[model samples]
Target: MTESVMPTYGRLDVAFTRGEGVWLYDEQGEAYLDALSGIAVCNLGHCHPAVSRAIAEQAQILMHTSNVYQVPLQSLLATKLTELSGMSQAFFCNSGAEANETAIKIARKYGHSKGIDKPVIIVMDGSFHGRTMATLTATGNPKVHAGFEPLVPGFVRVPYNDIDALRMAVSHWPEAVAVMLEPVQGEGGVKVPAAEYLDEVRTLCTQRKLLMMLDEVQTGIGRTGEWFAFQHAENSLPDVLMLAKGLGNGMPIGACLISGAAVDLLEPGNHGSTFGGNPLACRAALAVINTIETNSLLAHVTLMNQQIVAAFEHALSGAEGVQFRSKGFMFGIELPIACTELVKQALAKKVLINVTADKVVRLLPPLIMSADEANKMVNIVSELVLAFLATQPKASVA
Candidate 1:
């Protein structure tokens, strides 16, 4: 009941007892509309029946086995992932950080195979990769790196969505072997690059003979209304793609997919995970994919995204100093002032939303969220924002 038990998360007073579809219930029976969806980890909604059944069945059958033995579910899931992502091979892990670590190793090995002694990778500013040692070094925010000094080397930081800066960094760091980035910067305030930016990146990677790795941990699955966010663009696929978050709905699973020449970089013994591709996680991923396909959730995601974006724009377009930026379900409502306190107000009103980068109200709702649910979310947050803005001083309105 105190700080001695767990690290601080600045958590709200209420604790959720259960969740279904787009709603969560507190112990006292208060209902909260879940717009964050566990930070995009519940694309199919919490405890989806098919996914739940698969987990339950697999838990009874075989939950885990080491990487030493054959894992058929792992192989099956890999095949499905390759079909969905158009990648040549996959390396399964247990978290976004592990998937990214695999990506980092792949890039370095690819560089070494190409006869480069010291390989470097270009990461973007305002980007969030993961919290592990190597991934923290790859991350662009200094706040994640403040105490973790002597960060890993071989990483060159550049501004996001700036092709010129990327080119300059590649030229400056001759040992650079790859460019790693999130297709949509989720944790960094839901930032989306220009539509042509990914195309340019793909072209540059091809020309420079570098691996174009996309950290789709937050943008993959049906979150962006596509199998992968890059697929939204015409012929802009990456050589390497990292995935996690909603891949297994709530199950812990992460994967690094490789294609073109990068596929052969990781030999059998190069990397592995004890519980990465275990039967339980693989079955959950398979069920998640099947449910998405069967219910046409991808199309639903696109439709719901359009509806929600339009509604948010209509509601907040001329509301003093409010603005919205979105693509599919990943959205950020930017308020003129820092609205960190609004999280508490929204919770009091029984709505679950998150504020990121201080001023951006970031939302990554479940893909199956309906128009009614979306409206409820918009109305609750819109009222809260308008009320909060009205309380600010006139001089601060600017």
Candidate 2:
């Protein structure tokens, strides 16, 4: 099996046979609390009834008819997404990177439509857009760009949440036409900016006539205790909003929700996806959004977030260099020392978690996690952290 499978992922030894809500069961019937939620894809938890039913029903009805013909499910999903997002139009795709790739294309086209032959999109440092060529180039981490040289240009990098620097870049770069950043920097160790950051970015984009693009792949779809993280603010609106991850509740679906000045940027034949907006995917996404709304999961997520945060604080209180920043269920516990090995260690204890940006323990638990499960997650991880720190001997310097 290893011979045939690609060596792209450093997969874990344990193979999960099934998952429900927030728990995964391995082949041997061992249970693991899945705090990562398949890296935020299984938002409604594994095999959500509504989403599963939608998938099965749509499977019986239709699956793919391409973008050439009418896909009612696709149109319906778009309508609901735009209604939720306050966007005017939507272009469906299959993943976060693809959605972002579409957003990049839209921004470039919007710039060119204004006679700017080569448009420059201002991207933030520490941003994770996608793995495609354009998105990887736009990504801030130098490590992602190491092997992939001759990257796609037309993107200017700026420090995230820095208004003055962003404004300066716009004024300095004549070709700058758009500004892109995540609402909460999810992959950059779940970095949460100041409260006024999104408003400031929106104001700058509006005043500068630049498209404000938000990559909400990891932060969207009730993960942040709201329909989207931007909803936390009144004036938070992006011209090009990219979404994926939780949108389909595990089914592959990505969307580029456009509003304001950039709504009409894409033209026919300019860009499209063959499998994007297929009936099955659209139905899955619809079920996801509908289920979230019907079950009041947003409110649940908000309360769960508070409960989890309180537990984390209680667990780590008075511990030096130990603290957490969280919005809704998205959290990152920063430690005094690097602890990449914590992932394997935690897995050994049957609790799935991830370490990002070196020392930030990133936890994106399932939205349906009960208060009891949430407490269990916190307890296990807190014990793990305390144990790990206790085992480490003090370092001496000359």
Candidate 3:
């Protein structure tokens, strides 16, 4: 209610007081099916018992200590991340933006170590990196850069899934150090590239001697029914992987993973964070990972993803004015007409969803969502889309 609190986000009217599993309760106790899951942050579902217990226990012991000393939990988390990702090392940070910033620094440092000045990174169109100055400049959407002037240099943009364009850019700019992208473009309307696009990109990066960096901020930690979306594709493992969103299951921890030649770019005193890799955050992340493994949430995610996709296809596919694109729990349904208003309509029906790129209805439910909850989500949104389409003018039908 105060203008001084920074008016960056378009605030929703409802205020959630508590969340459990796949449901959120507002102040007045109205229950809404949480399909967005805080934009894919609560992958294990809200208030997970294991995560809550870990945070409580950790809070009683240690909360914050500067990264100037040895932290056992941090080391343990790094080891777990490396073993899972096949990367050599990890640098912990606070958010996706900071992780991306670290990745940028690593790429440039890798190039500088090779005696190259002014390194450039190849980014993809419709990709959402983050909101920091450098990461915002790296983002493909121009709207995010509207007020930010003098954007950071050293980024080359190319169309998503277009290998020829990448080749031309590489040929034109020999100083390019890395190619950064999202396995599934989350904020860019859940766009999934061609299955072979990542494989081709990996080959191109290898041939050109560039780092393959993946911004898995939204697609990692079982959001895509795998530890990382790159695992879903063949030979698409990245040299550098940026992780954040669900790493701590809403506790705000991030990491940048480096492998091969890019691992040793950051030496002692080169880069550090005051609050990064703190004991409490690492403990929280450890709990999230442990819970996912102990409960087999990855398999649950895969099963629920299949059920949700099948339900969507059964209800909306060929329903005269609907189309869908999805991978695992991440999905986007494109109505025949712009459905920006459907967000409010779905909320009115006690369902929560988001609209991105104007026409795509995006749904990113928790990985623990059951078959019943998944079908409810599909039915609610499908009915909203169908009802919305009926009101469109016939002349506007494409």
Candidate 4:
């Protein structure tokens, strides 16, 4: 077959034709239990009726009108998002990268406003922001920055979950304007920081008057058992919050929200996206928010997170060198050895999963996943891990 698409991604051989709830169907009509939710993009599952209908209805009525005119749906979505996030304003874009880029711009501009000629936004080690030049430079992964040198300046690096390191960094760099990071470090092997980490960071940022930016691209939209991951921390509201992944439940949409110290940073003509916040996208996002609210999916996720984590703990209790962690539907199991092959093994079992950071099996099942489906996914994945471990040479436990 002649391949026209760019080989940017090392895609799997199988192609899915359709999806519903937590199940995906291949071209041959085989079912694969989806545990990754399109890398946490489809929170409500594939083809959710509300979101699909909203897109369809809006497509028939309007899809794009450019950012020159007022987009009512965009305004409505912004209002709803602000109400939910406690943010003062919202800027929309087409992907997580753009949202983070918007955030980076805000940080730099805010720094410039303070008369800092060169500004620096502190980022964390092992964090993944986006693929754009600025965002990829902001990201802490070497692989993302390998081929893109002469990288954008003004981003400093620090260790994740270390408040003292952040404090030291802030003190060392007097021109630092903001601290940007993920709540759970999604692509960083689902690393969850100390419970007080966010609160402490918030306090430090407040004391220093620096923007506390959170990249919730993979943790927002109820993925972390909260409306936003920052909500999990007591009184931790970021100056800048970026979201995308599950915002529109598979639709392409990203938002950079602002509050104190970060508001009004980007003036008109400073930044704009032609397709951002168009009617179709905003309509779908509205439906997603409405559906989540109506279904009480947030509470459901909280409960399900408890249940699934307990299940994983019990299933892998005696497994050597295995550690499990989760926040809401974001699950990670770190094995003793490199287990990238487990992705292919799970696919053979008609279960879809992802391996990040070489050893962590990252699972992001849909929020609408049924208890039965959840149990099935757990069983399949647990069995696969056990079988794979049994084949490997046993290592001594500490």
Candidate 5:
């Protein structure tokens, strides 16, 4: 047998041929309700009309032009992102890793400007930035650092939601120049910190003269029932914000946005990308934002999230350790046991879901999902969970 692709992913047996909205079809045309949404990329759902149309149109008209040339669509997308996020400027890239890479570079340069030689940044535990060298090093999971020895330095790890511990750590390192964290840790089992956690971080950073950076790559683009997760969120604006996943709906697009003092760190020759900010990607992202606004999808996400959460609580009532946490469509259900098998089980029941952090069932359904669709997912997943629980031993699996 031949395997041309690298064995990088623990891929499932099934393969989807096509998708529309919150449903996908296999080669035989069997439908499966999509709850993962390509790991939160398809906020507009798979094959969204506006995004697809824009991509197709732009492909025919203009797909790629060197970054040296003016790209009107890219400028337009940047303007929309800046206006919505209250960020002053944006540097576009093709993926979240690149976006985070850009942010890291800015932090380093800003630190050098402030006369700090090492330029240390504080990252939280259980964080997932990207797979690139610097972003992987910034990611707090030790597993990512395995096999990649001599990991990128200057990133200090600390406990999440522990402001005092962070302060202590920062005091030890005079090179500390920035603090980066997620508004909601998506890959960390969708863990949300204390309500005032970000506010406290902003206060600490201001007092310590450290730049506040937010990795909203998974939570941005209306995933948290807002234009951006940090929009109107405690007035704790970050100096550097990285976004991807859902920004272009399904296309590869990442944005490193900056504001306040960190705005002028990167100059003309400091950073650049060949395929970034191209016309096609920009057109697709513009269409995603336009459709999200035109369809009022944020309100829909909020309503659907509430409905689904209430339904899950009612259906799994008193099921041991079957509690859930949700913000917008990003949800996590903590199971009593490791339920990695739930992926295939849900597929058998014509639904799709994923397990993360060993025992948390993570769901990132499409934001435009309807009331009826949300109820269907609740019912389908509830039945599967109850059945799976019955097969376990009497004692809790933990």
Candidate 6:
């Protein structure tokens, strides 16, 4: 904890020196089971050999050359992503925020193309987009907007998972250009919408001609048992699809993929990124995609999800004021009371976990996690949760 770095984050009193598949080692070389996976950035786990080797080889040969020059790796990466996502084109950047910023620009420009002077993108309440000014404004949490006043305009929000509210908002706003949201609201407490919600949204967007944009930064790249979360819905394809987190498997890269209405919205001068889709980053991303496909981790995630969910259900069946929900490796076990302290508690027990939206203990373990690791995580979390509940009054627990 040095004063040299900005104290923007309320960081825990621990630092890791290195990490492996699903484990991180501190200064003392103590191994800790990693369930968070760097907040879903390391879907293939830390320092995956394939991604690491690709990065190393590319760094040795050619790390970067301006986007002005044709980068073959970028084209290859885009081809693989398009093949997997059914999207037409991709614009790459450095993180999830930039990818989303690209989507917002496309929405506004798309609106302009349709003769709407001011475009509005429909966002959802309780959603977490990013920390950039525009993304923070797009985010649904007021805490994210407390100090950033006079927030970016032309964005409206409705309750998540409420299709009727979305319809009303869209109908009310004549200048609406697109609808942006996560398939599973990850930072919004792992809230999974109704099974057919995406299908319904696709229908509405098609009927209204609104560009359906999905911010799949957290739920994409096989985290949701599919290449992309939107793929879970039948015949549902987004006009704009944003991705980052797991795409590079730890390498910093973000992408905005376009299809249908969103294609060609941003012409040559509309937008660009300096380091976006560089040789090194794109190579790493390609390796990540290849590794995932080769390992068959998507199906593995489905199996492990079922296993982990059943294990928790059986373990906490008798517990009151507890709720468990999951989609793939994204697990949320919510308790009645706020348990933010459980992060340090789990850390003390040599495990990593995260808490979001106050009471929802979020677990995003590496997709490469084995059954033993999964069981270990569930046991530690369940024991800690039950113990925390025991200290509270039975009435308070609920």
TM-scores for all candidates?
0.98, 0.98, 0.98, 0.98, 0.97, 0.99
For candidate 3, the 10 contiguous residues with the lowest summed lDDT are: 314-323
Higher-TM-score candidate among 1 and 6? 6
| Model 6 lDDT per residue over 166-272, tens place | 99998999999899999999999999999899988888899999999999999999998999988888977999999999998888999999999999779898999
lDDT head-to-head 1 vs 5, winner = 1
Model 3: per-residue Cα lDDT over 1-398, one tens digit each = 47897998887789999999888999999999999989899988899999999999999999888878889999999999999888889999999999999999999998998888999999989999999999999999999889997899999999988999999999999899999999999888889999999999999999999999999999999888889999998898899999998999889899999898787789889998898999899999999999989989889888877788888888886567567889888999877677789999999999989998788999999888888888889898998887788788876756
362, model 6: CA deviation in Å? 0.3
Q: Write the per-residue lDDT of candidate 2 for residues 215-254, one digit (tens) a residue.
A: 9999999999988899898798899899999999889999
TM-score of 4: 0.98
The per-prediction CA RMSD against the true structure, in angstroms, equals 1.2, 1.4, 1.1, 1.1, 1.3, 0.7
* Better structure of 3 and 5 per lDDT: 3
- The clash count for each model shown is 0, 0, 0, 0, 0, 0
TM-score of 5: 0.97
lDDT of 5 by residue, 1-398 (tens): 13998889888778889999999998889999999899999999999988999899999999999899898998898899999999999999999999999989999999999998889999999999999999999998889889997998899999998989998998998999999899898888889888888888988888888889999999999998987777636878999999989998889999999998798889899999999989999999999999999999999888787788889999989677686888888999888898889888998888889888877889899998888988888898888888888899978653
Q: Which should have the higher TM-score, number 3 or number 4?
A: 4
Q: What does the lDDT read for residue 379 in candidate 1? A: 89
* Least well predicted 10-residue stretch by lDDT in candidate 6: 389-398
Residue pairs clashing in model 6 are none
Query: Which of the numbered candidates is closest to the native, going by highest TM-score?
Result: 6
Give the Å error, residue 133, model 5.
Answer: 1.1
Winner on lDDT (2 vs 5) = 2
